[model samples]
Target chain A: MTHTQQQNEHLWQLMFEKVAGVISTKDLHYLEAQLREDESMQEAFHAIQISFGHEDLERLKEDEDWIDILSVIKTRPRTTHQHRFGKYTVAAVLAGLLVSSAGLYFLTNRKTTPPLAAVTAGESPQAVVLQLADSKTVLLSDKTTNIRLGDVQLHNAADQLTFSSPDNFSVYGGQHTLIVPVAKSYRVTLSDGTAVWLNADTRLQFPFSFNGSSREITLLSGEAFIEVAPDAGQPFIVHTPNSTVQVLGTAFNINAYNPKQVRLSLVSGSVKMNTHGAAVVVKPGMEAVYTPPEGLYTQSFDEKTVLSWKAGKHFFDKASLSDICLILYRHMGIKAVIDSSLRRHDIHFNGMVDKHKPIQEFMDDVKNMTGVDYYFDAQGILHFR
Target chain B: MKRKVEQHNDKQLLRRLRTGDPNALNDAYRQYRVWLLVVATTYLTDEAEAKTLVEDFFIECWDKNLFKDVRVPLRTFLFKTLTERCKKQGIQINMYP
Candidate 1:
C-alpha cells in the first residue's frame, strides 16, 4: 500500500469509529472531502460503504454514544435493510445505509481487497442508481448485487419512497435489477417523459442524469418497450443490446435482447435506428432492422408487427414458431421448448396471442399447428418437441 | 404489486400434517424444502446446516401438528417459532429482534 493507501485506511478507521455514533454533515463532508482529493480515495470510501451496506445501523442508532452526540441523525424506521453487499447490519442514522435481500456471509473477517483505482463509464455503457426508501445508499450496478435471484426492487439513493406513478428514478451505479412484479408493470417515465414499459424479467440502466446534448440510456440485455418522450431541446436516445435508437419523441418498440438482431418498430413520430454504425431514419408505421456482421448491422423494416404488447395485443405478422417463443419469453417469463423431433416444423404463425388465454391454451394451439407436443411442469418448465 | 409466492394456502395439507399424517410429512417437506431453506438462511450461520436444520424443523413441525391453529397464519407462526428455536440452538441472529 502507498502513502495515500495508508491515509485511505486511516480515513476508513476514522469513519468506522464515528459510525458507532451519528455522523454529522460536517463529519460526512470532512470524510467526503478527504476522499474527493483523490480518485483512489473515492473508490476506497465506496468500497467500505458497500461493505457495510447491510449493517444494522439501527442498533448503532440506539447506542448511547450515537444518540447523545449529534443532530440530523436520530431516526430509525421499523426495519431498514437486511443483507446488502456482503455484510449485514440493521440500524439507522440520519442517513443510514440499507440492504434488501440477505444470505449467509462466508467471508467474514476476510482481508479487504485493494480499493478500485478508478471506475470508468462504458464505451457503450448502461448505468443507473436507485433512490431507496430510506436516505441510505447502495450501488445497483455491482454484479454482486444479484445476491438473491428473484423479483425484488432495490432503491439506492433516497430516504423515503414517493413513487406512485412513473417517477424519475436511477438504476443504482452498479449492476441492478429493474424488477416489474406480476399483475403490475412499471412504466419508467424518464424526466423527459419517455415511457419505457419494463416487463417482469427485464433490467436496464440510464445514468443518474443525462449527459451532453443528448439523452442516452444503455440496454445491457433485457426487454423494454420505449416511447421516447420527445424533447426538441435534447434528442432522446436508447442504446440497446446491439442497436441504438435515436428519436425526437417517437412511439417505437425495439427488441435488441437477442444477439443476432435488433427489431425496431415505429408506432408514430420519426426514429433513426442504427446497427454497426449504419443508420436508417424511419417514419411512422415503419421498422428498421439492424444486424452487424459480428451481429452488428442496421437495415429498414416495415413495422406492421410492433405495438402488440403496448396495446395489450400480440401482433404476429407471419412470424415463425421460434420467433413467437422468443417474444413470449421476453414479455412474459415463460419458457417454451420444442423437442428436437419438432424442429422440422419450420412453421410460420399469425394472429394474436393475448395474456387472457392461459399459456397452456396457446401452447396447445402451437402443438396442433406444428404437430409437436408441449408440456409444462408445475415449476413452469415448458417442454415442446 | 403481488406478494411473494412463498405463501401457500394448502389448508387440508396443513390440517393433515397437523393431524399427524406421516405421508403428508414427507410430501409437504419435499414441496417446501426450498422455501424453508430460504427462511432458515436468515437465521443460521452455516449455509449447509441452515438448510439441514430448516428441513429438520419442518419434520418436527409436521410431526407436532405445528399448524394446528388454522386461524393463525402457518408461515408467520412457523418463522417466529423458527427464530426462537434457532436462537436457542445457538444460531446467532446478528440483529433480529
Candidate 2:
C-alpha cells in the first residue's frame, strides 16, 4: 500500500475503534489531532460512514438469510448448557397429560355447584373459579357483586377479585385457591394488599389473611406477575413447585408452566431464589431459572418479551411446533393436532400471538407464513397439515 | 427527508429490540446484514472471513447485550461495529477515494 493509503487506513481504524468504544485515550487524541489538521481525513471518515449505509455495494448479493444467522448462533458452542426445555422434552409430553388430568380433577372435585347468581349466562366452561377456605368453589363472573366466606369478604368486579377482611386478626386462616382456566386471566388483591395477576391456566393458593410472621403463598401451576406490598417487618415468600422466591417488597414474574422448571424474572427491587438448599440473589432485569437436577441458572432477560403475556400477547422466537401447539392449547383452549409428517420435521415458528384475537386469525397467520393449511374438526380440535 | 424517516423507524426498531422482540431482531438482520457484510468485505478480501466477521458482529451484539447501550443510529452503529471487527482481524480498509 502507498503512504497515503496507509495513513487513511490508520485514520479509519481509529474512527472505527472510537465508535466501538475500545480506542485508547492516546489513540483518540491522535485521531482528534489528525482530524483538526487534515480536512481530507474528515471527508474520508464521512465517506466511510455513508458508504457503509449504501445498499448497492459489490458484495451485497452475498447476504445470508436471517434463519441462517439464527442457525449459526443457535449451533455455536456455549460456555453453559442453558437450554430451558431440552431436559424436559420427554417430561413435557408426559406433563401435558398430567396438566389435563389435573384440570379434570379440579373440575370434578368442586365441593359445591356454582350458585345461579355467580353463573352468568353464556358462562365459559373454563371460567375462573375461586375455592374458599371452606372448600366451596364459586365460579367467578363479572356480575358477582360480593362473596362472604367466614370473616373474609371478596368483591368481584370486571376481572379483578379484591379481598377485604373485617379485621386484621386471623378470623379466616384457611387457605383459598384461585384457579384461572384456559384462555382467560384474572387479577386478585390479597388481604395483605399485594396484587397478583394470574395468567391463563394458573392456580394460586394463599390464606385469606397473612397472620404469620412471613407472608407465604404457593403457585400451584402456570405463570403470574406479582407486585408485593412493601413491609420491611414482614417478608413475602412464594413457593413454586421447584423453587422458592423470598422478597420483602418487589415486583416480579414467575413461570412454572413446566413442572420441572421455575423461571423468575425480577422487574424491580431484589429477590432471593432458593432451590434444593442452593440460593441466589436476582436483581432487576435478571432471570433466575431453576430446573431441578440441572440446578439454577441466572441470566439477563428482556423485560418486554418476558412480561408480554400481561399485555395479552405472547412472543415466540424459533419455538418448536409442539411447544407452539401446547401454548395454543393452554392460552386459547384450542387443541392443535399437527400432521405426523410435519411433527417429524420439527417445524418452528417465530412471531407473536394476541390472546384477545380469535384463534382463526393466528391460524391464518401461520398458514400464510408457513404454507401450512389448517381446519377445525367437528369437535373443534384444530388440525394442521 | 426520506432518510430521516428511515432513521426514525430504525430507532423504533432498536427500541423494540432492546425489549427482546425476536421479530425486531429478525427485521433488523434482514434490513442491514447485507450492507454490513458489504462493509466487512470492503476491508477484508477473504469472503469467508468477512462473513464470519459480520456474523460475529451480530452474535456479540446480542450475546453481550451491546445493543442496549447503543446511542447512535442503528445503521451507523452496525456499520462501525462491523468495521471494527474487521480491523481486529488486522485487515486495512480499502479507501475508494
Candidate 3:
C-alpha cells in the first residue's frame, strides 16, 4: 500500500486499539488529533466505539446505522454486488406463489443472459421491481438495466441500483417506488446523491427530484438504511407508517416491519423521529423507538450486530428460536416447522451465519451450536427436533 | 458582536506576538498548540511531518506577521491558512465534519 493508505489503515488499527483500552498515551494523542480533523477517521472511530464490545453491541442493536457505513466502506462502486450462493440455492419459489395472487404479468428482458435465465411469468418473478410515476411497472431482470427520465439516469446492475443526475437537476413533481422481494436485498442512490439500502419485502416511494423545502420519502413497509446527502437548506425526511424521521446530513436506519412499533437508529449526526404530536431527537449511537401508546423513547444500541444483514450476514445476539426461524423463513426461503413439543422457543442462540450458505448448512451449524437437531422432511419443510 | 469580540482578541494576540515577547508566543502556543497539531496531523498523518509543519507555521508567523491584520478569529485564521497550505502540499482536506 502507498504511504497515505498505510497510514489510514494504521489509524484504523489505532482506533480499535484505543476502544479496546490498549492504546498508549502517544497513540491516543495522535488519534484525537486525527479524529478532530478527518471526517472519515471520526466516522471510523464512531463505528468502532459503537460496534465492538458486548454492551456496545447492545448499543448497536439500539443505534444500527453503522452497518450502512461498513457496507459503503467494504463494498465500493455500490453496483453489481455478487453473492456466491451454495449448491442448494433456490430462486425463492415462495415469492412466485406470493406474486401469483397479485395477478401481475411479466415482460421478458431483451438482453437476458444464458447463464442466468430471465425471470419467467410464473416460474421465477423478478426479485426487484421499479414502479414509475406514470403507473408503469418495470421488472429489473436484465444484468444491467438503465432507465433515463429527465436529467436523472437510474442504473440497475445485479444487487445495486444507482441514480445519477446533473448538478442543477430538480423536479417539481413525479414519484417512483422501488420494491424488494422476499429473500432479496437491494441498494439505490437517489437523485440528491443520498444512498439507500433496502431490505427484503420493502417498498420505498421517492420523488424523481426533491424540489420542496424538505426532501421526503415514504416507506410503505420493511426496513431501510439512508445516508442523507449534506444539504442544510433542505432536510431529508423518511415517512413510515407509524413515524417520520427528519434528517439533516446524517446516516440512519428505519425498521418499520412491526406494525406496533417503528424503530429508528442514528449512526452519525442527528435525526428527529416524530409520531403523532410527539417527537424525539436521536443522537449518534442512539435509537428512537416509537410505539403507539408509549409514544417515542430513546436508548443506546449496538450498530454492527443490528445491521449485519446489510453485508448479507446474520449476527444473532441471543436471538430466540422462533425469531431465528422467522428470519430464515423470510431471507433464506426456508420453511421452518419447529416441533412444539421438542423445541424450546425461549432458548436463544448467539452466533454468526453467512446467508449465502445453504439452509442445510445453516441448520447444521445451529444444531451444533444449540444442541438441537433439525432435518428436512419429505415435503421440503425444515423440521426441528 | 461575538465575531467582533473574537476578532478583537485575535488582533491583541498578534500585536503582542509582534513585540518579540517570548510569553506572547508561549500564550499563543498554549491556546492553539493542541488544535493546530490535530489539524496538521489530519493532513500529514505523521508525527514528524505534523511537527515540522506546525513549527514552519510559527516560524513564518514570527517572520511575516501572518495574522497581523486578520479580521476573523485566530482559530478561524489559522485553520483557513493551514488548510490552504495542506491543499498546496497535495493533502486531501475534508470540508465537512
Candidate 4:
C-alpha cells in the first residue's frame, strides 16, 4: 500500500529472478526480513507462498521428477487467471509470459534447440518404465508375451508409456514369457524404461530391473522392435545364449529364436553386435546374423524384410517352407511334422503372409501354395505323410 | 487423528482434507503447490495462467481426493495428475499458454 512497501516488493521480484529460484537460505532470510519490516509485505509474500503450498505440489513432490520442474515454475510469470485483482496481476502476467516462453522453447526443443543437436535424428519417442505390483519385474520385447502376472493397464504415447495400478506402489511382471502369436500383436514397457512392440509368436524373459550394471533381457523366439531408453550411466544389453547387442540410445529389432540362429537389425542410432568375440558396430539400415558353429554374424540389407512385421506384413524374401512352417506353428498355435521326404527339397518359398487372417485361412494358403495335402489328427498335430 | 492412509500413503491426507483440516490441507499444499505450478508452467507459461492452472489443480484435488490408494509415489501422482490436466486443456505444461 505505501510507496516503501511497494518498492520493497519490487526488489523481492528482482531478487527472485536473479536466483533463478532455488529458494536458498539467503532468499528465505530476505523474504522474512521484508515481511517483518512491513505488514502489507507480509500479506504480499503470503499470496506468493500460497502457490507453493498447493495440495497438488505435495502429491507431486513425493514423485522424484519435481526438482527441475519446481525451478521453472517458481521463476516464471503469473497468468491472467492470477491477475483478476489488478496492476500487480499485470506485472505478474508479463513476467509469466517471458518465463513460460523461455521454458517452452527450452523443453519442447531442448535437444534440437539450435545450440545442441538433438543427439539423434529427430524427435524420437521417450523412454518408459513399467513397475509391477509384487516387486517382481520383466522387460518386454515386441516378440514376447503372456505377461498377465501383474495388475496394471498399459498405455503408450511417443517414447513414454506409464503403467498405472490400483493395488500397487510398483507393478510386477516376474519372469514370464509373453507369446504374441504371429499375425497378432501386443505391447508393454519393462521396469527399466524400455518400450517393446511384440509381433506374432514372440517370447522373452525379463527381470523387473537390471539390478546389475547392464540392463539385460533374453529373447527366446519371435520378432520385436525395441526403443531402448538412454542411460549413459548404464548401457542396455540384449542377450541370447550366443550373442550380445549393446546400445546406449538407439532403435533396433531382434529375431533370435532357438534352432534358427540370431538376427539383430539396427533401425537408427548405433549398436555393437557381438557373436562370441566376432563383433562389429551396426549402423542404421543394417542387419546382423549370429549363429552357433558359424559363431559370427554377417551383415546386409534385410532391414526392410526385418521390419515387415511392424508394418503388419510378413516379409519372406525366399525363406524355406520348413522355416516358414516353423513360423506358422508358433503363430497359429499348431504342431507340424513335415514329410522327411520333402525335407531336402528347396523348402524355400517367397510370399507375404498377412497374419490378419484366421489360422484356417493360413493353412489353406500354405496347402495351396505347396500343393501338399495336410491333415490335422485328434492330437492337435499336423502330419504330411 | 490424521490417518496415514492405510490403503496407501497420501490417501489419509486426502481424507483428512475431506473433513477440512486447514493445517493438514495447507501442509499438503505447501508440499506440492509451487512444484505443481512449475510443472504446469512448463506447459501453461503465463503467470496469471500458471497461477490459475495451479488453482484449478488444487480445486480438482479438493474435488476428487485423488490420493486414494497412492498407487504411485506422490510426485508421480502429482506429475501424472497435472500432466493430465494440461493435456485436457489441449495445452502443454511448462510451456506457452
| Candidate scoring better on lDDT of 2 and 3 | 2
Best candidate according to lDDT: 2
Model 3 lDDT on a 0 to 1 scale: 0.62
TM-score of 4: 0.42
CAPRI rating of model 1 = incorrect
The per-model lDDT (C-alpha) reads 0.47, 0.67, 0.62, 0.52
Best by TM-score: 2
Model 3 regions lying over 4 Å from their true place? A1-126, A149-152, A164-173, A340-343, B1-97
Q: What stretches of model 4 exceed 4 Å from their correct place? A: A1-184, A210-212, A339-344, A358-370, A373-385, B1-97
What's the DockQ of model 4? 0.09
Residue A149 Cα positional deviation in candidate 4, in Å, after optimal superposition: 9.0
Error of 4 at A129 (Å): 19
**lDDT per residue (tens digit) for residues A1-385 in model 1:** 2333334333543344243232345657777676565554454345444434434333222223211111211232211231112122211111211111121121111112211111111111122323222211222332222211111232222111112212333332223224332222345555455667754334456543454598887665545677776678998888876677888877877765565666777778888877776777887766666666754334445454455565445666677767877657644556666667765656777666767667777766766766667777787867766
Summarize candidate 4's per-residue lDDT along B10-32 as a digit string, tens digits.
Answer: 55655665564544445565555
For model 1, state the Cα shift of residue A220 in Å: 2.3
Order the numbered candidates by TM-score, best leading. 2, 3, 1, 4
lDDT tens per residue, model 2, A1-385 = 1235435545665655454333568879998888777664565455344334433333243333223556644665532333322221111111111000000011111112342223333223556877656554655654333544445666677788897776555544678788887788899999789999999888899987787899999998889999999998889999998888999899999999896989999999999999997999999999999988898899999999999988888888887767878888777777788877654445567888998888788878877877778888898888888
Q: Which one is best on DockQ?
A: 4
Q: For model 4 chain A, where is the 10-residue window of minimal lDDT?
A: A101-110
